[model samples]
Target: MAFKIFHPISFIFLIFILLAPLGHAKRSTPSDKTSSAFDFIKKLKGCHKGNHTKEIHELKAYLEKFGYLKYENKSQATDDDFDDILESAVKTYQENYHIKPSGIVDDATISQMTTSRCGNPDIANGTNFMQPHGNKHESGSSNIHTVSHYTFLPGNPKWPPTKTHLTFRFSPNYPVSSVAPVARAFHKWDLATHFTFAQVGANQNSDMIIEFHRRDHGDGSPFDGPGAVIAHAFPPTDGRFHYDGDERWSIGSVAGAYDLETVAIHEIGHLLGLGHSSVGEAIMFPSISSGQVKNLHPDDIQGIRALYGR
Candidate 1:
C-alpha cells in the first residue's frame, strides 16, 4: 500500500475542505423561512390609516394579493399611504377573521395575518366569502336547522352535472412521499360526496392535476413561499391544485411542519367548487397552523352538499 504525504499548502487545503461542510451545515429551517417572510407584519402591528410608511405598502400588497384591498390601477395599489381605502380593507379582514373590526393593525390582526394560509384569495372578483352568513336551513329533521358558513368561488364554478366521476393525476414534480397522503384526502372526499376520484398515471391525461410549485409557477397566482401562502387550488373545470414547495410538509401532526393531508383536503374542496369557510373548525378554513390536523367539519359537509346534492 502506498502512503500519501501532504505538503504544507496541500495540508492547508485539506483542512479547509474538512471545515467547509461544517460551516455550511447550519441551513435555515422551514420555520425560520416561514416566520421571516411575515416578520414585517409584526413591526406594523400598531399601524393604521394615515401612517405613511414603506411597510404599509407591503401590508397593502399583502391585502391586495388576498383580495382585500383593491385598487383601480397598479400605481394606487403600490402607494405606501394607508388611506381610508386601506382602513376599510383592514376592517373587512378583521371582521372576516372574527377579530374586532377596528380598522387598525392590532395584535390579533397581526397574528392572524402572519399565519400560514392557502394562496387563494378570500374575496374573489369583489365577492367576500370570508364573512360568515350563518344562514340557517332545516336539516334531516324539520325541527333541526343548521347554520352554514361555507361559500363558493365567484360564479360558483363546478364540474359538469353529468361528470360525477373525476380523474386526478399527480404532476411529475410532486413529491413521491406525498402521494399516499393526497390519496387519503381524495378518499375522504369520495366518502363524503357524490363524486368519486381515481388517480391515473402521470403520463395520462386527467381531469385534475396536483403539483408542488414555488413562487410564480404560472396560472397567474404566484405562491409567496413558506409562511404566507401554503397552497392554492383552482375551482372546478380548471382542476389545478398546487402546494407551495417551500413549505415544511409532514405526514402527521409534526411540530413545525404542515400536515400534508390537511392541506390536500382543503385544496380538494376548492377543486370541487367549495370555498373558504368562516367556521374555523372546517377543513375549508383559509388558514391552518403547523402541527394542526383538521378533519372535515359539519360546515364542509354541508357546503359540498349544497354545491352538489345527493
Candidate 2:
C-alpha cells in the first residue's frame, strides 16, 4: 500500500476544511434561517404597482404561499415587476385582513404579514375564507347582531355522518409534555361541536395525527421556524396537524413562549374543516401573539356549527 504524505500547512488546511461545515451548522439555527426568510418584507412596505425591486420577488412568493397571488402562466409568477395582478392580490389581501384596500404595501400590511400565523392559507383554492360572510343575530340576544366571520375550507370538506367520533394520536417523536395541553384543546372542541375526539396510543391507528416538525418534514406545507409560521393542519379526512418544533412552546401564558393549547385549538379547527376567520378574537383567526392564551370565541362555535350543524 502507498501512503500520501501532506506538508504540515497542507494538513492543517485540510482539517480546517473538514471542520468548517460543522461550525457553520452550529451557528445556522432554525430561528436565524426563519428571520432571514421574512426580514425582506419590511423593506417593501411602500412599494406599489410599477415599482420593480428585487425584494418584490420575495413579496410575490410570500403572497403566493398564502394563496393571495395566482398566475396564469409560469413567467407571470416568476418576475419581480409589480404589475396589475400583483396590485390586485395585494388589495385582496388587505381586504381580507380588514386593512384599507389601497393596493399598496402599507405599514399595517407589513405588520400583519410579519406576525406569526398558521401555515394554512388565508385564501385556499381561490376562496377568500377570511372575508366576513354577513351580519348574524347573536345566539341569545334578541336585538344584538354581529358579523359572521367564520369560514370553511374550499368545498367545505367535513367528516362524514358516519364518523361522528374521531380518534387522534401523537407521533412517536412528539414531546411527552405536550399531551395534556393538546388533550385539553380537543376537549374544548368536543364541548363546542357535535364531534367527539379520543386519544389513541401511538402504535394504534388514528383518524388524526399530530406532530412537531421543523422546516420541510415531507408534507407539502413546510414550517418557517419560530417567528413566521408556527403551526398548521389539514382539513377533515386528511388529518395531519403539525407544530413548528423550533418555537418556544409552553402549556400556558409565558412571557415569550407560544401557548401550546391556544395553537392546538386553532389547528384543531382546521382538522375539523374550518378555515381562517376574519374576527381577530376567534380561535380560527390566522395569526396569534406570543404568550397569548385564546379560547373558543362565539364566532368559532358558530363556524363549526355552520359546517357540521349545531
Candidate 3:
C-alpha cells in the first residue's frame, strides 16, 4: 500500500507542477512550441467571459490536458469563452497547488502555466507510475491506499554496492555556477544512499555525463525550449542528464525564477532510479517550481532507505 506524509508547502513560490502533452508530436519550429495564450491572458483588461477566443480555447486545452478541466466531449470545439466548468477547473487547480483559488486566469496563474519543468510524466498512459511498495497500511483498516512516495523504473533494479564511487562530469559549455548546484544535488543523494559521487575533469571517463542543450540534442527526448520541459535524466546504471539550455536557470530564491539546484536534485533522484511520487511533498515528486527550495521529505528518505537499505 502506498503511504503518505503530508506537509504544508513552504516555498516562496508554491511549486511548479508538470504538464503532460495531450499527444507527443515534436514541433519542428520554435514558434510551434511557444504559446501566445499567455501573452493574450496578460493583455486582458478584465476577467474573460464565456466567449470563444483563440486564447480562451488555448486555455481550455491547457487546463483540460493537465487534469484541471473536464468536459463531456473531447471532440467538442472550444468556444474560446470562459464558463462555470472552466472556472471550477481553474479554482480547483489553484487550490490544489496552494495558489489563491480565484476562478480567473490571473497573471500568477499564467506565470505558473508558462513555467518550464522536467519532462517526466506525472501520469503516463493512464497509469499512475508511482505504485505502492505494499509495505504500509492505514490504522484500523486492512484496506490500503493505492499510492506511493517514490517508485522505481520498469525493473526496480538498483546499482550494486560495488559501484559506490560514481564519477560525473558536466559539459564545459555551461557556466561554472551550474556545476555547483549539481554537485550539491549529488551530495544530497550521497547522504541518502550508499553511493558517493566523484566529480571528474572533462577529459576523465565518467559514469554520468551532464549537459545543457536546447531542442533535438541527439536524444529521442528533444527538449521544447522555454515553458515546457526544463530537464530530464536517464535511469540508474545509465546516467545521462540533460537540462534545457534555453531555460533561465538561476540559484536565486526570487519568485517565478527556476532554481537549478531544485531541478538537479529531482533529476538526480531519477538518476538514482527513482520514479515520480504521488506524494506532493517528496523530493521525487514529479514537479517543481521556480524559486523553490526543495528538501528531501521523510517520505523521500523512507523511499531511498527502502531501495538502498541506507
Clash pairs, model 2 backbone: none
Per-candidate clashes come to 0, 0, 8
- Can you write out model 3's per-residue Cα lDDT over 59-128, one digit (the tens) per residue? 7765655445657865442766677787777776555445688887677776656655567644444444
lDDT (Cα, 0-100) at 266 in candidate 3: 85
By summed lDDT, which 10 consecutive residues of candidate 1 come out lowest?
1-10
Across 141-160, the per-residue lDDT of candidate 2 in tens digits comes to: 57666779999988899999
Off by over 4 Å in 1: 1-34, 134-146
Error of 3 at 91 (Å): 16
Clashing pairs in 1: none
Worst 10 residues of 2 by lDDT: 1-10
Judge candidate 3 at residue 116 and give its lDDT. Answer: 54
What is the descending TM-score order? 1, 2, 3
Q: Which stretches of candidate 2 lie over 4 Å from their true place?
A: 1-36, 135-146
Better of 1 and 3 by lDDT: 1
